[model samples]
Target: MPAPYQPAGVSVGDVPGVAQTAPRPPLREDLNGLRGVAIALVVVFHVWMGRVSGGVDVFLVLTGFFFTASLIRTAQSGGSLNPFTRIGRVLRRLGPPLVLVLVGVAVATALLLPRTRWVDIANQVVSGVFFYANWELAWTSQDYLAADPSVSPLQHLWSVAVQFQFYLVAIVVVFGLAGVLRRSRGVHRASPPPHVYLVLFAGASLVSFVYAADGTSRLQSWNYYDTGARLWEILLGGAVAALFAARHPRPTHERRSSEFRTGRTALAVLGLAAVVACGFLLDGVNEFPGPWALFPVLATIALIAAGPDTSVGHLLRSRFGLWLGSIAFPLYLWHWPLLIFTLAYSGKPSADLATGAAIIAASVVLAMATVRLVEKPLQAPGGSIPRIAITATAAVLAAALVCGSAGWNFYIQRSVSDLQASDELDPFTYPGARELTDGATAPDADVVPALFSAPEDLPVTSVEGCIADFETRDAISCEYGDLSASRTIALAGSSHAEHWVTALDMLGRDRGFRVVTFLKMGCPLTLGTMPMLGESEYPDCLDWTQTVMSEVEQLGPDYVFTTSTRPREGGQGDYTPDFYVNVWNELTSYGIPILAMRDTPWLVKDGVVYRAIDCLADGGSAMSCGMPRGAALDPINPTLASSFRLPTVRPLDLTSALCDGPICPAVVGNVLVYRDEHHLTATYVRTLTSELGREIAASTGWW
Candidate 1:
């Protein structure tokens, strides 16, 4: 059987569009046209979508084209492929401007950002400079996205990281193959065809792309930003280059041939249409660089094949196109930081027409100057001076990143401690903490019960395990409550459950109840759901919850308590309130009472977490450091409250547990309420035991 698709093959001594009879080679206007369109598409898309610019796809294709073209030329002339020389050339060309922008961004960040945000900015600077920003992003996504006013200035470098890594891998693969081919010249020409390299790379890229498409809904938090998961985009471009170089094109002189003007025009129109489609159709929340990405990639490939003699090619090769192409690199460099910074500082994200215009204009001017003065000089033959200057500058930038982080840490220690001293609320006298921990406050009693100390052994019934679920524990091995205990209570949810451990353990011991915790990070207990950060169907969440419920139902728990809301954007939108209702309905079906605790306030206003000390140090008044109770619980979930009409469910408002009359105090009763956002600290939870103990014993009539 014939293969699925035959890739373009490498044929020696075939230059597609150069007139065979001509003496001096003219510029490939067609290639320049391709560059112009690609860059323009990228700029337009980024300015609008705040999404990945398909322009990156264009750049990838161009990289493959140029790199392959150079290698083929060198190979035909019987010259050795030198990886070091190539890398040196790339560095000399791309490094100076990159270093300057990085340094400038660091300087700007240091001057503008608050102390609370310094560590993140410093780490991002290091990651961006080292070409590992993608990994940094992936790591952060585990906790949160850069959806804050304090987002790093260097976030745009994720693309650069992807490109740099791709270059390294491509160099090794291509050079290794070239060396082998030369050695085996005596054996056979067609033994392992040169085109196979491109074919294999393309096949792998397509597979990964499909994986990315399918994986987005499931692993958007982790794999969305991971370099390993994103490698396919870069590989796709490289594969295109290899395939194109491998092909021996038809003679261009004959007008009636398939490669003539009419054919080229048809392809160019299709390509342009694809570009327009991407610009209009692609948006945030769509699965990207997956199947939907074919519009941009196929369009780019089409334009590349439409030779310079065509009308569209000629237009693309014109002065305007070339000028935009010239500044494309710097344009891309400056646009994101400019937009992100503007949004960060403005305090309001509503984009105005004038501001957007100003940003675009400023970006253009900056790109023009950088390309003309900075990029051009470094890319020139005797660019050694600029390279040295850039190296010195980058070293300064690296030092600044380190010093800024350390200095911010020092500032937090000095200033926050001074402010902390002013907080004179007595720990022993505060009724909330005192009453909650009254019975369990003794340091002598083992606060944490033996059963709830570690993860519980939840039973699993399915053959499909949690391989696709990276952080989810198998139910078979992770159970929580002991059925033998007369008073059985289960803690189940996300880290919210983990945060309540100290209080729960204390309550369990004092009340003589078994506190079983069924928890996973980001994976809250629901009637139905999958693990938050992986591909496995969260049949486990439902399964685990169902099993726990069965156990709880059989044993007849006094109360099944869990936090039901988190402080998010505008202090609203908790995980599916409907699901919470279903869970309540399920518990009531088994005659079990439910006590749903309202979520604690996050310290930072905009959903980003900040160290309490850092917040106090950064000129933020005590009020701004944490959400006020009214602000934190503005839009309450009435749906959850409605379930309490069943008489078996109750809403245990912990709003007062960590809050004053109106303000949700960051610290309560002289103790820090949280180690991070939304989760009570183990230390603080100990303090809450007294108040919680009194309330639970009184409310449930267990006294």
Candidate 2:
């Protein structure tokens, strides 16, 4: 349908035949077909795994071979590779279709997505337009792909970026190397042999491949989208092209070279097997572009080396292959965003079988339609449009992508401003007050012991020097509730307990106990110092908590409440028992009665923060947004419950206050509970006061 890829060989009289032992064959349809198959495989794999297709490696090898051959042949014939002409050619090949897809995505995003999603989409649009999305995604991949909900539409550009980077370097280096060689005594010969360039490029590519194989940890850093890790793939193809060019014509019926001959069936089976293995055997989490990646890369090398006259190449170059290959670019571009949008709309993963199938079907149809209607018609010869007109059209599309993304971002921001101002928009209001009193209800998981060795029961630590007074970071003034208040209730722990002040203050008002709070964010009353959020240096939260513990010991509160251990470095954040046991033992030595509240559900849908409004906008009821009691807390942290049996450490659940049955309402008892994704709102804390007011009285044994 399109310009038919211009067929792949140098025309007659384009280059002189070197002193070759064999004739070079014509451009193989089988090889082009193989390219189509490779692109299809990539599309299918990405739709299913949200990962790269091993087939892309195959495409890279083919690109390398074609580009390298062209460069080497021109160099050997004493033709300088004009940089502007080369860049113009590449831009003509890749730029038009890419611009169309990007602008289309921008228009679609503006029409469909909500305000919360626009900021990220706008950032992606800018990076994608400039071809730097690889760096953006590489940073995002650090947390775990499984946790991420939505993948960017332009994520596939990482490879394109890598290829572009390689081409820029290769053009300069190849031309520069030719100049330097011509000046040397060894190179004054009229034409330098093409193998010299091929051998050197191949050698560099191989070295990089070997480096990638040996040190894969770097893949997550720079190697993932780096040209070095990928150079060998292109170099392998280039080597083949160089070999083909330095050949003689064979008499009509005879095969000219031993390397060009192959059993068609064997090549087909071998290539197919290699492709399947890459898809099934490789995992998403492993450092990609690492040693394990050689399976796909080398398999592609094998396929390309087999040649199109062979049975494998012939099959690949069939009508089916050609059609698919022709549409591959558009298909690859459209598939990811379609899948991403589907998953984002559903508020879940599309990894299941049914959804995956649907994604594949939709992607293929869209690719075919776009290729036939837009790409082929516009790019086709004799279309009657001038080159200037075509260039103007491209400019218009580029401008639309920029303006559309900006306009949508502005619209979403305006909506947020307007909504925040309206009294009727109370449904969207984050209940900061209610969240303050609901302390232990926030969901947090425990730190893994392999990353952090939590301390155990100390030998009857005395109260003498243990009690140390410290100034607070926030100016929370200590006021006398009542001079006659004999009973002191200490809230000594992390923000888990600090958030409960609204309820505690109410209890102090209704009951006779004085509420004293000694808490900091994320410290969680742990005995040892661990890495804190944001700050790279070891957080002083533990040191600050130690000071609070000492002062609480001197105050001698009747009841001391703390929370479960949350995430530390190296392990996922989930509640565990060892963390609670460590804290309980430290406070128990001071002869203070302890009350441990189970943490609430940390609502992270698809590794991204989800607000109640996100769910409501998507047609999900407010209750569907919250995690159930059984889902959030695990009876008690497993490590603590298994080893220690403390009578004072009572497990208190206000789950009924947050959820009913398995349905945890985003708004609890008509009050919004959480302010941010995990933490409770200050306003929500006041509402919990009535519910916990009586519970504390009963639990403290001070009725």
Query: Which candidate achieves the best lDDT against the true structure?
Result: 1
Write down the worst ten-residue block by lDDT for model 1.
3-12
Tens-digit lDDT track of model 1 for 1-703? 5311100110011232222222323445555545656666665555554444466666665655555554444443445457786666555455556766777776777666654456666667777766788788777763223324455667667767777776677667766676677777753221234486677678878787877776564556555566655667667766766675577655556755655678889888787677666656764224454566666777777887765666777777688876666676777778667766776677544236677677778888988888666655543334488646655565676666656656765654565344333323234443334432343232222212111111111112111231113334443223233434577776766666556656666667666677765555566667754433332344445655665566667656667877665554554434336577677888888777777766666655554445554454455543566666665565455435555466766655555566655776554444445544455655566667666776677568776
Per-residue lDDT of 345-434 in model 2, one digit per residue for the tens?
566764577887888888888777766655554444434565445556766776777787787667655654443343221322333223
- Winner by TM-score: 1
Error of 2 at 571 (Å): 17
**Please, what is the whole-model Cα lDDT of each candidate in the order they appear?**
0.58, 0.57
Please give the range of 10 consecutive residues that has the lowest summed lDDT in model 2: 450-459
